[model samples]
Target: MAADSRAARPLQKMFSEVPATYDLINRLFTLRLDQAWRKIAAKECMRENPRLVLDLCTGTGDLALSMAGQARPGMHIAAVDFSLPMLLEGRLKFVAPGQRVGFVLGDVGKLPFREGSFDAIGIAFAFRNLVYKNRERDKYLSEILRVLSPGGKLVIVETSRPRSPLVRLLFHWYMRTAVSFLAGLISGRGAAYKYLAHSAINFYSSGDLSDLLESAGFRRVQYRTFLFGVCALHLAYREGPGNMENS
Candidate 1:
């Protein structure tokens, strides 16, 4: 059996233990830039005026709450995560009046939704766990594609490998050292932060991500870099509704 087959359970357990300080550690590590990044992902989610949006792997619901603030009246948002504690933490911060937001506890590998359910999907920082070295990568990607309506879009904001060698080394060192130590210290979840540091240090580059998305059947993929390529936003499109060719 592939290691990733077992990755899900441990990852779920790791996340469940850190809900209390997850948001705070994020703010500290990124200097509160994560919220801004989520807002960007939220804008991409709403750019096409999607009727239904799904926040995939919505840890602490930050991305969903960001989307709720900008979501059109009557628009529906569904946020899902396997970790119950994370979902509960996110629920406490959700206060978007007149905006529809629903939190569901479930695994991303098997989303409980009909085919072509959401017009758009957004994920923040959780893309790596679903793709990087995950033996079930195809299954998870296919499930995402399955739930997206025709001509729908999938937006992603995630850590990226820096392009420059020197900067990359510096960033990796910081991630492995300061980020790992500080996050563990603050969250009291050393193993989780250790995994976080390891994952981010060795994740894919922007170009690699584009190819991955394209090969996964996204008709088109667009990328934007942030903080000198340390983070990236990916916009992936399904084929046009009704099998029409998108120009």
Candidate 2:
């Protein structure tokens, strides 16, 4: 998918405006649970002790940095984002750690790597943007599969629907009113938070995300929900061609 595409225009414009306060706004909006959630996702990404990891759509590289912090010796971490400003912010954040993770400015639809390049891949809070109402969703999934090694993990932390109706209603109300208001006020990026709020309110349930991943040929999908199920962490594996056929 091109950055200039219609579906991505608002996203591009929104992200371009929020890099300065993106991390901080996220902390406030999620009441700092976002960091803890990322830590859990990072742990799952390293569950197999992958030698190389890719953080896709690594906005400001928070999860990438978390992975870098706990990385074993010789564990290489890399991140990719299409937004130059966001990638620059990620680089600045990496300075304190002496540049442990490689940051690349590129599109997810056309990852700049060879087939089977990464031992594991992780995305935080951005999975919905990749699949929600996206016409080129299959293309992006194909690119992700192209770069992931067989049996490589794809760990994702994303907003999800609550199984409880009451919890879901309250979550949606808070998102629409408080989160959008404060996040937009602090970040001065109302459109971005509007998109964020809308997406979070409408994103897939855990089961739905798992089914989507499996339909794309990933295997053994599992998920854990948190905070009355408003957020979810998923783990899925890339099945090799032979294994995919057998399965």
Candidate 3:
């Protein structure tokens, strides 16, 4: 798909088009670091001790699965995405009934739920993928805020550029060259992998995103960088009625 077309199409369309190859491409492009990143995000997301969790943009339910494992054994998770094909593919992996895990087809930007509906919400490598054309993106962030319970937590896991000059230079070259080539060979979507690398470098820095979270009404936001700053895990909490904990 051309860059413009990929950018213009609805997220569901692109994801469904590539559903069969999504996981393979993801692993190859990330060099399997994606797994470790999700694990860290899951652990942090579980810190709030949520009873019901929401995994937005839950592609193939990888992050949701991790979150489920961290939550209490019977805890329920609402894993939602706009792409039904991707959801179906993900559903085949697990045998969770609605009591434990449930999958829904919905867009993250326009989540279907009520206020303070979930104890925690998680988005991993899915924020940037959202079709944010203009200020419309703010609505998506606000929706997240509205759906989160007071004192609930929001965890984000996404790639970031390394700060070290020499290391960043090498990482950039590898992503532009070797990573794209390997991803193309396996998934037949080298161009998508190319865009993936570009998206990582273009996405917000840990600090910038933390500010966005604050602007969205979250308090006591903090972030942790991993893989020498190649990835970031952001933690933000919805303010409760009482005094908020600084940590």
- Highest-TM-score candidate: 1
Evaluate model 1: give its TM-score. 0.93
The candidate with the higher lDDT, 1 or 2, is 1
Model 3, runs deviating above 4 Å: 1-8, 96-99, 131-135, 242-247
For model 2, residues 102-221, the per-residue Cα lDDT tens digits are 888778887888999888899999999999988879999999988988878888999999999999999999998977887888888887888889988989999999999999998888
RMSD of each: 3.9, 3.4, 4.7
Q: Over all chains combined, what TM-score does candidate 3 have?
A: 0.86
lDDT of each: 0.88, 0.86, 0.75
Give the per-residue lDDT of model 3 (tens digit) for 171-203: 778777766667666767666666666766566
TM-scores for the candidates: 0.93, 0.92, 0.86
- What does candidate 1's lDDT look like per residue over 166-232, in tens digits? 9899899889888899889988889999999999999999999999999999977999999988999
Candidate 1: worst-modelled 10 consecutive residues by lDDT? 1-10
The candidate scoring highest on lDDT is: 1
The clash count of every prediction, one per candidate, is: 0, 0, 0
